[model samples]
Target: MALPAPPKANRRAWPALLTLTDDLLEDIFLRVPTPTDLARACVACATFRRIITDRSFLRRFRAVHPPPLLGFVPCWRPGFLPAQPPYPSAPLGLAVADAADFSYSFVREGKWKNSPWIPCDVRQGRVLLKCCRNHGNLLTSPSDVELVVCDPIFRRFVELPPIPDDLVDNRRFDLGHLLAPTAGGEDEVETSFKVICTAANHTTLVAVVYSSVTGHWCTAASRSWTSLSTAVPLPCPGGSSIFDYSQGYFFWMSIWRSSSLMFDPIRMEFSIVQNVPKHSPKFPVVAVGTEGIPEMFILSDDSFHLLHFDIAKGNEPSINEWQLRGTIPLPRNCMFYTTLGAAEGFLFLHAIPSLKDPPDYCLLDTKTCELKKVCGNHQKRFNRVNAFFGFPRSLVK
Candidate 1:
């Protein structure tokens, strides 16, 4: 009798078939994507409902993926940071504003080149930054002559003290960031981290961290601030950028043209990550994320194909076991805007192209595999989606 057809009833068997109780079974099912799945599992019985909502099960969701290689993707806009006169007496950095304000600039196509106030050279524009959790507020950096902290979202920013005139003139370049405490509350939002690289002096270094608690930039007994030179350029968003905090250290990159320097906050060192090995004759890319892991890639068929990587582990020198992973290919003549917060299971993409009927945007997806677009509409593009931004906190908890 064909071995009794291998027990046909086992497909839907609930209690007896599996060792787990109805409650436990539903808990496993909660991890499923849709609410419909949760609803169905709940209806399986009261036992199912109890397990599905169990706080413990949800907590596991906090880490949706293997601890992500934390990284930052610049919140890219269409045009460029507004630049000033052909007559400005001093050198300037990039445009800085809250995320909301940046979006308005982002929405206005060609404004980058079109805006007269915006510098003709985008590389000299302000480097903007947003909170990993709070994506609306922007951290602004205009130029070495003056520093302003304005919340484009609330229209309120604290004016930062300008660097000394002598210092500004002496320094060839500058970089900055707004950093919050590693272990703190949702409300802690004041301290700022700034760095000015004196390229003219052949010295690369960080400036200072102005602490709201003490109302001054934290200074060491040596009467100087800390330095974060990871041999990698601690990219100040807007260019080839990647700045993340992992293993109690700040990881970043500062890209020149074909090369970059990796900076790790803990070691306070700068290391050259030569694209010669990671890049191709085609396109070159690199990133530092989730505990300062370095991921190098190349463009092939409009996608950034990962070549190899090693995340922030402990000492003994972390290494990226280089290997081709996947790619995020552009649909048209577009490119990735930025990559931010590797949370649950996906990586976020801030992408746009001049030719897009509407415009490109930051779309979240995954690092290991290509993802289908969540909402394809410009109106709803920024809303955080599931499979992107790694895994959802809701699912984890």
Candidate 2:
């Protein structure tokens, strides 16, 4: 029996793998932070690549891992419509920057080859771009606008169906996207997304939804928009929409009413989140999360202050009271600024320089209260801040 103890290789194999079970291997693979890193790991061996590419494994990875701060997409465009043939062509492109370390790059793809695409909203790691090619003259003819949902990280896009004739002719529509998790544990990067176009159909609000599951568009009927007029008097024509990931609500800020238009994608219902904390009229911005999804900070009194819209506590049906959390100060005289975006307890603020100083971008950590300069004149010239947040990484072919 002792002489048949077996080869040395066989004895070491069992002990070596005792601590590295299938579950442990999957956990180690999920901890890879970026998609680029994940891709690199796949090349190590065929077995690892197969596990990473598995549909179930991808779902579990995304569920367990929190998104990391990638960079900001700065858009530079004069208007939503392309200039006439005789006019000079406009400059439109997306600038990608490492807001943490100040590294930067630009995404120049065929989608924006000729005309600039207006970035309307960012959510679920995708940006909604409105193609400005067919939009007719603002005064004379109806605009034939087309919407596109883009994954800037992957440099890919999916064009949505054209808007209805009436909705385009009337010129009253807003776009938003929801990248929900699929029930079947499909690849997150390939499928499981919905685009909603809210248009003012005469006196009512009609939403056209496009689902990746069906590969087609459908209309959602709701009476919630009937009373939306009281909260948002005029629909935001080609404006940005923000979604609350944890609470599952889309928010549209109403400049006229100084309130927020909240839409529940599940119920197809609309409600108003009113009593937002007053902010600077010059550069009003809302950073949706400080510690989590419930706490939000708005730039007020030339500083970033925390507030919460407690929807569950209020007795009123329409408005929820905003509770103050804390205040975050800025560099002296750096008052005029806009909040580009937020994620993982960080706020991206774009400071507008006065005549004496230069423009700057900064990253603020809400937890540690540390402020760091991400970009300045040395990195790149940014005219506008389109999106600044954590971009998710997924393996989708």
Candidate 3:
């Protein structure tokens, strides 16, 4: 079965696979399935890396291809507790799941992983976890806290400098609100974002600003929490909050007070939003609404649009209020829960089944009306579900 061997010159002659135009290379790279794949491809060869890492190439890639769903981080309750040594504490770490199948991977390889840091808020793709460093006493004054901003998908984290001594010892103030990725474009993972800290005293809302671009933490300005009275839900800054990035505002919920705090990052101003009506409907209020109906934020026509839906016994799911839009019919038996929240065009219902059965975290697409079960039997572990929403994978600095 032996055959004549080919010439050595012929065997050595092979064309390079990367000998293509930049446009062609970009087209190939854009087709990569996920961000992880893109990252891996960038490391394969110098030419490929250079082409993929170019600013224009990355921008075009994002425009042509949709962002990936990085995963969900289970933000545990009893957040930002005082430091106690002997008592048992809940493990503070994110339960990261895959976008496609909702599979999970570890953050920082799950090292020690016993810290008490809990997530305050997740914006753009960044999770802000904070914990008190040292507490002389919890009754009289607050403790010095450290905030760690992390990109769970990237597994990169940075700890901001400690709070100033005077701010820590002040009896009237508390780090009630924290928001991250303070700067840079929303599409890019830039390290230039700012961490805006809102401290609530008796009557005034003091803001402490942290600039990653300048590497400095200074008190930006102060404003009065003057217009409204405190509500029964105990309106802490980021405790029950949602960010409207299009409007550059963060709406903080006041459960019984019937008002929400509207914070502006650019102007550093605080205004009262009175349109959030008092509703004892069978459902829970999720996010801000448009034209007097509760709805989620939507981006369209170079401006922000509101997407609202009604879940009732028999009526088809339709957005009728505020210059009526199209209707999306839901599948049968899908409107079981009366309370829900919407993010990224999906509805997350508040369901806690009977003790004999496990709880369910169900997601329904507002556009498609397709229902899927996510995070099966997670209720047995944590006390309460703090943050659950769709987190699209982006380059959040």
Tens-digit per-residue lDDT, 1-397, candidate 2: 3566665664444444355666787988888876667889989998888889887887677667644443455542312111122211111111232111111112233243454565655555566666554332232111344566666556567767765564444545443444433333453345557777655434555566778657776666444445654533543333434433334555555334366666666667666665655654533334445444545566775677777555442233355566677787777756477666554456667676764566676677776777766655423445444433445333244
Query: Each candidate's TM vs. the true structure?
Result: 0.45, 0.69, 0.60
- The clash count of every prediction, one per candidate, is 67, 0, 10
What is the lDDT of every predicted structure here?
0.35, 0.53, 0.48
Where's the lowest-lDDT run of ten residues in candidate 2?
85-94
Residue 116, model 1: lDDT of: 18
Error of 2 at 258 (Å): 3.6
Query: lDDT by residue for model 3 over 265-295, one digit each (tens)?
Result: 7767665544443233322234423333335
Best TM-score among the predictions, by candidate number: 2
- The list of candidate 3 runs beyond 4 A from truth reads 1-48, 63-66, 77-115, 133-143, 151-156, 165-169, 173-175, 182-189, 227-247, 281-345, 351-355, 366-370, 381-397
Error of 1 at 209 (Å): 2.8
Cα RMSD for candidates in order: 13.5, 9.1, 11.5
lDDT of 3: 0.48
